[model samples]
Target chain A: MARIVTFFIMLVFWVLISGMFDAFHLGVGVICCLLVAIFSHDLLFYGHPDLLWVRDIFKVLAYFPWLFYQIVLSSLEITYIVLHPRMLEIIDPRLVRFRTRLRNTMARVTLAQSITLTPGTITVNMSGNEFTVYALTQKAAEGLPGEMETRIARALERE
Target chain B: MRELQEEAKLRMPWQDVILQTSVRVLIPFIQLFGLYVVVHGHYSPGGGFQGGVILGAAIILMALVFGLPASKHYISENVNKTLSITGPLVYCGIGALCILFGGYFLDYSALNRILPLGPIAWRSFGIFLVEVGVGIGVMSIMLRIYRVLSSAGTIDQGL
Candidate 1:
């Protein structure tokens, strides 16, 4: 019931957004919506939005761009280090674990993805709110869950 | 162990809910945007391959947030099966058509006259249909892969 309503709402929203009011196109859209609905109807009732606290959602959005910038910088640094001939001498691959204060699954996943995107660090395991990370250098491994951790916590309102 | 069980408790079951309200409401727009991507692929950065992946990802997101069963209900196995074949079939058919027109295989420029439009815009219409075919094929294959992997139990248990 709720799924059907959501589908109709989405269909109407799509029609409006696309300005596709032609009978043929609208008919096709409706049919496709029904088809998709028939297949996906079971998805209507699983997760609850109650877990998401919107108060911090926007904060994370704001933080993401900055995080992306850091990711780019780190990627460049890693790329340069990898391209350098003395890369093996510089490489100090080690695994480090740290407990994060961020409580939300979404925040943790985002943080993990960002870390992986940064090139030097790869998130191997996240268990019991503890993250196991593989870092290329000792310097890179140390003090993690440091400033970035605090920033993510702030963004997620985990504190 | 307690924490793990508690985390496990956080997992929702089938019949716990129906379809995703957001996906139901948003799919039309996503599909429309996907169509746009398919149509404009030649002139822009996105081609049939990229657009198809995005479309599949959107549906997958709907499946993840909603439920796999629900997504299957919406997309269906038969349709996806046909789609998987359709991409290669279309590519091959187009190539054959080009051969019939006394051109090389897969030369889409030969089909321009089929639309009754201006001089065959090979980059636009020819590439557009090929892209659409590719998108449909890729999307179906990806969805099938998701189904196979999700059913394997490891996806949910490990994640």
Candidate 2:
């Protein structure tokens, strides 16, 4: 089941990337997609998918808008911080550690990447559910595991 | 906090949830892109060798994150050997086959003796076949090199 999904996905991707509709190109695409799908179907959707993850696919798209918004907002914030005259006075660099509620491995990773993508914070290390982040200011540190975690959970599903 | 740091250091990369999960999500795409590179190599800038490296790098990425032993489970000793041998054989076999069909070595149009495809089509299709073989060879050999280099030629029990 997963293998078929992988094949279609690969085929679509191949077409998009190749930008060709001729029979030969299409035929080769089919062959290559089949080869890869058979080899790594499990890798794409591991542990007995059963069509549940198809819903997650749609749900996960909801995450990008939020993430992009955060990125833009944080980029502006970081720019302001960097351009401040009294940058050293406002910048209170510190390490922030927090345990995450997300149990799924992908969820935790998404949270970590979200945090890093948001300016003023950098994910330095992760151990299990605990993340050690370096924040450039007190404001950033305070936002640890904030609304981002919840948003990611909603988008990707928490295990 | 010191104890926490120490404990974090004790954990291996494969045991880290974030690394493992992110890799799972990213690896299949990486491989698919590599295949894309190989297939598109003729028309595009990249071909079998470059694409083969990408394919090999994907597996190497797996080994790096999952540790040598676990990576072996994914690729296996026997399969790796087969690929390494097969890649070159595919490459050379085509050359020899061309000779048997009355054309010089590697002259793909000569394949017309076996398949009734026109000489012109065979010429084009022949390169694709060679590229596929080369891609497979490169992917396998790249992984083999990494396995040997990282494990100090032991092919076991190291990164």
Candidate 3:
């Protein structure tokens, strides 16, 4: 099975890279590998139905660097808001729901996680096509379902 | 022969089964890395807890690749239950031992005299064991929660 093969390849790659082939430590490595194999069996077996194409995998990977940049930018903005004396006057917190175009579970989950990582936006709840998001500012909430939803839709090729 | 072939057909796909085997093969190296992280946690950026989770994740990864049944075959539910309890028991036992030596609960300094070794020499080992226990408890509980919730189809269906 692909699952078992992936597990073995990952282990072999790890051993080759880590060079943990010492005599006494070999037993420990074996035990650890066994545990990994035990836990990860489902992923290997299922192979993520949502990730049917290589392009989908690449798309998800490509989103990470951009997501990190967004996180940094938002963190700085949050820091500035926190340092300001009249922070409460500029900040508005409320829950707003919007529909998303992404149909795949993985893409939606990634979007939620990405939004949560960014300051000023927190995903409160998600049900079907609707997402309840908490935003610190209305400006932050304005494009709620547009930019992020578009990006995730693109990543998932779901339109 | 036809009936037997049909039963085999009902099993998971060949690709998935291969992936599961591969994941199992790879577990040894990931585990060693986890151990390295655990042992050097105090001096480096990681610790026992991180390593333990990584180790657990490796297994969980295999489970994801293989079917739940195969994964359960590799790591029985009983073993998980035992590990879930054993970690806390070990931690508590260590604390009790410290108390017996007339030191505060979890005081490692008191353990030196009991072990026929120097205090500083044994303290690191004591801390290492404690961290292992904590890691085991946390990892088992997290995995168990995931398994239970997923089996109940609550989280999976919601996703």
Which of the numbered candidates is closest to the native, going by highest DockQ?
2
Model 1 compared with the native: what TM-score?
0.49
Q: State the DockQ of every prediction.
A: 0.10, 0.59, 0.08
Which candidate leads the pack in lDDT? 2
C-alpha RMSD of candidate 2: 2.0
Q: Per-residue lDDT of A1-159 in model 2, one digit per residue for the tens?
A: 888888888887787787878888778778878888888788777566666676887877878898899889889988998899988888899988899988777778888888887888998788767789999988889978889888878877734
Off by over 4 Å in 2: none
All-Cα superposition RMSD per candidate: 9.8, 2.0, 13.2
TM-score of 2: 0.92
Per-prediction TM-score: 0.49, 0.92, 0.51
Taking the tens digit of each residue's C-alpha lDDT, what string does model 3 give over A88-138? 898988778777777766667677777777888987655556677889888
State residue A136's C-alpha deviation in candidate 1, in Å. Answer: 0.8
Query: Which CAPRI category fits model 2?
Result: medium
**Which one wins by lDDT: 1 or 3?**
3
Where model 1 places Cα greater than 4 Å from the true spot, the runs are A1-57, B1-32, B35-159
Quality of candidate 1 docking, DockQ? 0.10
Ranking by TM-score: 2, 3, 1
TM-score of chain B of each: 0.77, 0.94, 0.79
Predicted candidate 2 versus true structure: per-residue lDDT over B1-159, tens digit per residue: 576567767874346666677787778778878988888787988999999999999889888887888879888888999998998899899999999989999999889999898999898888988899999999988888898889998888656
